[model samples]
Target: MTTPTRRAAQAGSGALLHSLFRTKPVDRIVAEGGQGEGGELKRSMSLLQLTLFSVGATLGTGIFVVLGEAVPRAGPAVVLAFVLAAVTALFSALSYAELAGTIPVSGSSYSYAYATLGELVAWVCGWCLLLEYAVSVSAVAVGWGSYLNEFFDKAFHFTMPAAISDSPGENGGIVNLPAVVVVMIAMVLLLRGTSESAIANTIMVFLKIGVLLFFCAVAFTAFKAGDVTPFAPMGWAGISAAGSKVFFSYIGFDAASTAGEEAKNPRRDLPLAIVLSLAIVTAVYVLVGLAAVGAMHWRRFALSGSEASLARVLDESTGRSWPSMILSLGAVVAIASVVLTVMYGQTRILFAMSRDGLVPPVFQKVSPRRSVPVANTMIVAAFISVLAAMIPLGRLVDATSIGTLFAFALVSVGVMVLRRTRPELPRGFRTPFYPITPLLGVGFCVYLMVGLGGVTWLVFLLWALAGLAAYFLYGRRHSRLAAAPEGGGPPDSGKGAPAAGEGEP
Candidate 1:
């Protein structure tokens, strides 16, 4: 693990300060556009929008789909796993908030890496983010399809064929049709532009939260405290395993940090978003987990996919089909929102990278009409839809955890590195415990990574190797920072040459 040199790390920091503080390409674009068009990019997001985005992203598939899997692993102690995962997420999120405030860019971890680590490492981090958000969204889409099938079966007495409901590995007939459909829908919404998606997400967020509240209300009626008597029947190992398994629920909290560029006041709102989102979501997760397990035995959970586990919990506790049907419908809506939000994050990161010349110019092309990256959104949707339709959600979820842990580890390390090297950088929020907090984040993330299967590690390794190869073969030669003339570009051509204007390719 070669860490970035202090000097190379400062390169991006300089760029950030210059881009944000001075009159540069970004300024030129804003000036060229009327006032409102440029203003939206920099205007601060409200506390409500920030909170909703975070909770909405974090609440999706993890609770609806992961609870069954985790319950089996940790027995009745799954609630503890939720608490521990929240702590780990809290540490990393604090670090993320600090960096987001300082860097204030759209690239999230990728931008931070570029500013501190250099071109090569930034490229790798961006690649890891691709695995984390894009693939995970698709995985969630597959889970959404399973729940949709169940919802339809109960509500309208209709069902998709098992083949269309499940992946090939799970004895399914064909493809995950609903998963594909949902991804396409999200794609269409994204292409329509950011405002439309935000409005849709806000509605989805309400629906998801309402359903969870309903489940909690109904579930408590069936709750029996005796079911949790042997809380740690599986012991510390089980608690750890469950925590690792369910950590994905907390993965999207960083979505708040990603919007630092667009934030009204990133330094103030970003930290609040990160902390508040985690606090709220963790409380909901713990309460829901406790209520469900308290209502029935943990042994009742069968680990097939999202639908099977949820169906089991519903029938065992309620002894009726209607509640399960409602839960299934909620899963469909929640997971679809999650996929949309997560995919949107992925595209924005790519947009930041392309704007910096880390990737191809095509990814940076914001539509003159809508201010959305039309080509980039379509390209990402097309790639992920195939995964959603064909790949098993279980495999994708496990892989996504690995990618997320890797990025968290990097951020933790970056926090320590930046503090020592550039103490002068203005951080709106500082991580609580300094070396201890970041180190804890790293240790916890690594422990979770170990709990994942060997196959996940192997796949992650392959992906990283492929990313490194691509960076050297393509990105390094064409990077904007590399092409720019020290002071910031208004340079020459498209490929390997500097960019001149705001929207020019």
Candidate 2:
């Protein structure tokens, strides 16, 4: 016979285990659109606007600057590296498309995880996003500052003092004043509202595509077959190493899906924008890599100091001053847009987490007039500003890549879990081939993660540990779900609207 005390003990253990893995109700998240506490963000963004958001975020700072560093690591085989990174990106991207189309929520992978995997996993995913968005923006800002300094020296014959232009801990400088300046500028624009940010992103997307196309046209004119003859000189090890670093270039497309609430047609447009933007950016990255190496041998390419390598490649290829000058100028504009879009993503993820009472209520406070999370944006900006001023770009890029790969892998797994747990859930987009697609997504993400090197793994472990500590200290006890009535906890995305593919009328 079971004793009463033993029964109670077993019940207590079960409750503890349940609470540890408590899942947020998807219907509740979907219901918030029609009757949430704070006023909702405007749904003024069209499919085209959302697509531009994806491209604008992914195309800048990366293709413009990464080649100088990646080329030397992989020799001319960095082209294959870009292709490998693209395959990894494509798989995770498919998983993202399925979830974004299904949930149509602001939290991206974090929200997706909450609806399927449980709160603990959701918190971990959100924490990883903090690392991904913040570090990527800071790295882009540092790259922009270097390009800005170069533009000033060439166009104006003057450069900012190295003491302020370079990062504090590296390069013998006091602070990266220019990097901090760009972050502040983006902060101001976001506080204004989303509409202004969207418009700027659309314009910058066009400019970035046009400029990269221009570079390719000019570089091919100087293309020499001999330059690529010794391709893969460093072989597969080099290719894999550089692929890990270049993976950072593919991260920003998910930022488009983060705007699910403000999108005009979340179900139809979110997945399209995610896939389209990635395809566009991948094509551009490969062509530019081929053009650059064919014009200038990979062995001689180096990012020594702060020079903008693309602009240098253009100048050397064309043997003229104007082409390089144009490339540098375009790079400056392109990177600022990247900063704005990425910072917006960081804020929204915090806003979503805060709304669930995971972090703190302070992050949930939205501005009524602007329909934006003003306090959240400022908090993200302040922290990112400090990091940009202090850290080196190379280190920031590596850390960002590792964090993003982890979050992406989790999202891929979440897709498979949701399918098994809630097969009845309406999915606007289904990942083709089901389990295989998501499994490969997880596999590739893990492969690239290992390529990030041992140093990055140590830093990432420390970061993940801190997130777990914070969750237990505050998030667990105050979780909105546990506080709800006997059935479960609450808030949602589209007001209980049946998912587009979930047998909706």
Candidate 3:
């Protein structure tokens, strides 16, 4: 459908130039949904299952680990930061709902960009997504280590030593063994298959929610009006900065969109799951942030407050250890679930790319009995486990927010493009405020990216450069769209556009 261009015969500057601007026909992608020659994944997830997947992915480390770091930036006004970030997330969520409802395929934002934007931009989106999901998994895994250590100290009366628990250059440690172990555990579970993983995720979600509610009940008992005095002490600048940092918490909602092909009734359920998960997580973050701040003064919240900060707050407030001990268990469970969801997101994204011939076919190979991309999961798991075991948590999180923002911006743009290009296609969900919602989604995400600083920008540019090199060196010549015969596939598909995701915050 794309004029049947092949890199083998046109391996010249002409091919290179064509690679940059070459676009996939919307119709061809639409056909990929029904009776695709490329082999389809089984659709088994319902709306409830999809929602649990999203919530499980989103409600993990961010609220548990990020609050302590963010509160110091905005003081009591970190509550407002959560609110602002949720608003920012809603705009993108609406766009994702539109695209997911329209396409209902496995690529997420990468798929949407390919159908509406072009191949090169799609490659870049997928590349940025690699940073988002991989780093998120690593970062969350590291946080998991902290929580696991905390749980041992609280319930078992002992803790892992710094040498083996912390990452390189942190507290005199070289690598995080717990982090590596958690990541591998997730990999094993994933290898078992998607439905098995989904059920595990659902159980974890309920456990996490129950624990947060318990914490809230305990925290409000210590609430004092005096502590919240002088809210917004650092002013709007601080609130904005904190908002950018907390934005990571809202990224997991897109995980639902990544399961587009595997979701039963994807067109109807994907958008619902995306929106519902965002709403549920936003409420949880706001309530948790509010309760924690009310329980203790904001200045006490710092980087040292990481891992078991909420538990520490409860222990200090009630002069009891049992509350903190319980919270430690919750954090451990929550972080594990996040690792699982994030790793799942990365493998599925790679699987979609492989099926499109943008990457090696090994990633596209599905297990005969399990119906899962076992090889893809292993490759992603190995890379993330190394990153989790080696890198400091802070560094791992730096590129994730910026990468997610860039991907979200592109998806917002894609929504507008498709609205104009294929206006006749029925969308299951549409963004309210028309162009304004998407415009705000793009503008706000860019603003947050700017807030991340020059160092992050330089790192992202370097990463983007590496992705581009890989694309030109290998992916361009091997792309399925570039080699496929004309008049293949359907008009266009958007029921569940697999997406670019940063895992649970």
Candidate 4:
């Protein structure tokens, strides 16, 4: 159905915010309960499956593609940059863990903001997350397309048309067919349900980690000490720049955080999942970076789509195409898997927003049989698919990093706000270093944001502003919190008195 008029939405949202947050405990903004009857959206996912979701979502084609871009900037020190990004991610993960423990909601940072900051801020937070998840899936799909082409030519001895393979803006290519196809497939899987996708995602994660491990082993054989001659050839600036670029790889930690509502024992498992995933991914990124740089000159690892960067290294080391073919095949599968998991994350975030009336209600329509938001998944898939098909992989990656960094900055700030306002609220997992850890997270995220080019920042700002406008026009008014009955708020919203939806603390 069409959402409320823009002016009405803004007025409604403003009124709702004033009423919801002004109270002592903010008890006037709970969500409508029994959304899908009694037993919709079954919690069939285990801790291991959830961990795979986070890792699979985060570890996709980014390393395969962006590493080339980052290596030139940091030279040998890009490894250090990966560690810095991981450290920042860890802090954010800690804050996420605490919030998840206390709230255990599906809205992620958006819900957190509503409970602590107010309604308007919560709407904006949700808007920013939209950018992070949707744009990220598009970026990963494009990256996957790049590697797919490379693998096809090297292993199958065939090449697709440039127009079908390359992005429209860059060069003269028309569309990226492979990227678009993968997005469509992911949408279908999401419509069927999460259980199946979780299984597929777990398999994909195994393959990606395995491929990286294999590459590390093989690349090390050709590793030469001379490659480290000018370790800091580009100095700390370059190192920091590379680190900033690589930071995009760690955005998946929140994927784990997003599963708070479904997780069994979110308090303990959420924190563990976030920290462990970050640590493990960091080690993989750093090791892969070291192997790539050591196997060849840091200066010559072309930052663009070098289809055969890994293959060339393998050829140089083993003097054969078989090893290169193996890497190529593994990369193709890994990229596809990343697209699936990341797209799944995007659809879920959209579903949460829609259910709250922050977006179109069409997204909230769950399938009777599958218990999944079929239309929402299809819409997200279509948008990302068109983007992947038409846009250059490199440009899409740049946009993805900006959206994630902005959202991360917001979450870090949210943590501090909660600490001051809701000291009484039970927090199961507090961030260890308090202000220090969160401050560092903010600092690191901002640093990475700056490393992105002027064009990227400009585009991100324009899109975010557009999202805010949309919220004011539509989401703000129709929010269930605004429609909540008197006598405090609703339970799901953390505004009403404790009841069925009010939930157990």
Candidate 5:
């Protein structure tokens, strides 16, 4: 006995629910791989380039800067903390490797979620990635600027004035010029072509590894058995706290997955690159941590002037200023490499989302001559440069870690969901230990997210709410999936037709 008005309202609500929970089919997602608005992404990246891209994005300010903060919390047991954090990262890396192989798309977790968890969840994952990659790059650029100032003071005996070097409101500063400059440089390299950018990152990665080795050599020269006494001074609580702190060091190991469309053999090479890069970064961090504690007592890491702890250790070990200067030079290179690769990850994620019609089509518009998303790169670079240039980004930086952990947790769940939904699908890499590994990944991610405390949780909640608003206002109406026939795949699947304006300028 319902009236026409009531029946219409019920119908509208049903339609909204259907759109929210609709999942993209696996075959359809794969079929649309490189078919963006303009040119396709060139498949030019090899295993080595992909591996170094992750390494370059990951092995930055964490080891160079965060190590000092972590060592003070865990004492000589900081070495154990590094190992523990690596173990946590390993669990999630396994899930990422398996999914990256099975899907082989540029969206990373967002696409994986769309193929398993539904469109609403997929949009949330994509939003989290935006926060994780964009904010992390901006924060790292600010660190790079400080290190550049340190290098200049050490090597050239000249430092830029604080007003121009520091962010606004810090020491009477106006803008962080060096941070802006580094982001712009990374932007230009990205615009040229993906292959050229990969080559540049490879060189920078090797240079930073050599610099870390040089540090270990200098640190070991003054090693003493006395520094090993009283290990784990703060007990298990301290080691756990330090493990949570150092986990940020492992954030960018998934950078390789964002290059799925650009990789020559994504299914095989993506898994290898993700795992290999994590192993290399963990080994380097453990080696440096052991060497740092061996050369100087752990208590000194808590003292004043411990900002540049590794370089400080070098000065103490060699009783010379030259070694510290070399260390500062290495920090400059290490951070800039991170800026380049991470910014690259951010653009590719947007490109994938744009192709799904969840964002502006400009993000998917590639330059035919370069086979790269030129407008997307430029837009992302401009936004990040502004954030790095003007924002202080102090405690707000922790939001990046929370956002990343949330995405990682969703990926782990996606693995389990996909396994149940599509057991017959071929997988280039199977996560060994199956459900146990993915469950542990989810647990570890939650553990880290909780450690970030209440303030970070509040920030994440606000961000999620804003994302939902955007979805309702724009994403829902424009979604390509919604436009497709009911229970069918994407409308343009297998066609791979380029959108209008599809060639070189």
Candidate 6:
């Protein structure tokens, strides 16, 4: 009884829905791990290197600069905010650990979403990851410039001119040259190869940890019980708001998961690295936050600049320039390590998406000699450099937090979906309490996302819209899964197979 026009409309709608929710098989995702353009990604990262990579990425800027910003909002209760953020991150970290052990792919949450959720959700997760990593590197690079200027003033009695050191429109800055310089430096190191970069990150991670401990030792010398009084001055609302803000600090704990294909023992190492790094980072952050608040009144942090908060705290605690100088030096190394590891994570995510034909093929083109994604690294560096040179840090940070929370929420959902759909799959690690843990992860992520500013939500919505446009325009048409025959995998590209030595742990 239906006319041809109505029948055609129904058919078109059905086809669109089918394409939107199509899930990629987990086995296919694993089998396609190392098949890139020129060569496969080399697996050389040990458990120590993987853990250090996450530590290197997570330990920067948030404690160094964001502490100052959060303190005014929550008073001494900023310490509680750090703990709350860590708790939020912990729930999701457990989910990430389970999935990383089971999947063991370079795509991180994006690949997990594809294997469990759908193509549309996978693209959205990947796009959010792009926002999280790229903008976080830019934000960290901006913080690096502040410390670099502090180091210059301390060691040489000189600082770069405001025009060249600050982002556009801040302090009359035309460009943040130091931020650009750091991004380029990270790019060069990434081109060298993953193992070489991890080695450098390990050294920097230890140095920064030493500096933070030194900060705590000196800061405690001036600790007063009075400063920590009235800890909940603004009550639970203020602590929750600050928790959302400080959540930016916890963004990089998943950096280890992005290296799933590159880890020497991904099944065991990825989960261990993820959980260990979060524990280590959380302890350091809580210790530093307590020390900072106890050494000085929370209100005073506003008078001092937030960009170089730790150095200023050290300066005040000791009434000496040398301590601040030491802190500044450590911050420069600390933040640069962040930029390096986060940017590496970004390139690998793009590489995975590219392999699925969701982005340009250049992303998956591994360098034959170095076994790194040279072109992908360069592209990411160039884009991040521009952002660091142009955008203000405050705008960059909140936008990054929202994107990260959204991605984390999706990852939590993915864990539950995979468990229900493929309970028989071998898992090297399993989430404790199963549905309850992942459900709490999703709940915490949503709570924080709601606490973020309305402007950040608007920015995230616009970003999601842009991703949808890109996906429909290019990704949907060229998707490998879409082109495959029914109940079959995509045709082999004949690039290369996964490297030997990968096996269940």
Model 6: residue 190 alpha-carbon error in angstroms: 0.5
Query: What TM-score, computed on C-alpha atoms, does each candidate reach?
Result: 0.85, 0.92, 0.90, 0.87, 0.95, 0.94
Tell me the tens digit of each residue's lDDT in model 4 across 262-320: 55555556566667777778888989888988988777777333555666667777888
Pairs of residues at least 3 apart in sequence or in different chains that clash in candidate 4:
6-473, 27-489, 27-495, 28-489, 30-490, 30-493, 31-493, 491-502
Model 6: residue 475 alpha-carbon error in angstroms: 0.7
- Model 5 regions more than 4 Å off: 3-12, 304-306, 490-505
| Local accuracy of candidate 1 as per-residue lDDT tens digits, 1-505 | 3357666669888765553322123222222221222222333356667767787788887787678789988987999999988987988998887776666557777767665555666678889899878778887887777678778889999988888777767774577878789989999988886667777888998998888887888778888878898889999999988887787789898887666555556656767777888998998898888878887778776544544665566676778988888888788889888888888889878887776665787887766667677888899999898887877766646776788888888788778877876676556788886889989988888887887788898889999999888876777667655555663455322122111111110
* Model 4 clashing-pair count: 8
RMSD values for the candidates in order, in angstroms, are 7.5, 3.0, 5.3, 5.5, 3.9, 2.9
Q: Going through the candidates in order, what is the number of backbone clashes in each? A: 8, 9, 21, 8, 0, 0
Candidate number that wins on TM-score, 4 or 5: 5
Q: Report the C-alpha displacement of residue 442, candidate 5, in angstroms.
A: 0.8
> For model 5, what is the error of residue 375's alpha carbon versus the real structure, in angstroms, after optimal superposition?
0.5
Q: Which runs of model 2 end up more than 4 angstroms from their true locations?
A: 1-9, 33-37, 169-172, 230-238, 302-307, 391-397, 490-495, 498-505
lDDT of 1 at 107: 72
Off by over 4 Å in 4: 1-39, 169-172, 302-307, 391-397, 485-505
Candidates 2 and 3, the one with greater TM-score: 2
Q: Which candidate has the top score in TM-score?
A: 5
Model 1 pairs whose backbones collide = 9-116, 12-115, 44-263, 44-264, 45-264, 163-172, 163-173, 163-174
Candidate 6 lDDT by residue in tens digits, 1-505: 5799899999999988888888887777878776699999998999999999999989987788788789888999998898898988999999999999888889999999998889999999999889878887898898888889889999999999999999988999999999999999999899999999999999999999999999999999999999999888989999987887787788889999999889887888899999999999989988998999999988998888787677778888998899989989999999999999999999999999999999999999999899999999999999999999998877656676788888899989999998888877767689999899999999988987887788888889999999999999999988988888852376433232333445565
Displacement of residue 359 (Cα, Å) in model 6 is 0.6
Where does candidate 1 stray beyond 4 Å? Answer: 1-44, 162-172, 302-306, 391-397, 486-505
- lDDT value for candidate 1? 0.74
Provide the lowest-lDDT 10-residue window in model 1.
496-505
The global C-alpha lDDT for each of the candidates, from Candidate 1 onward, is 0.74, 0.82, 0.83, 0.71, 0.89, 0.89
| Model 3 lDDT tens row, 16-66 | 666565667654554454222234556777789899899998998778878
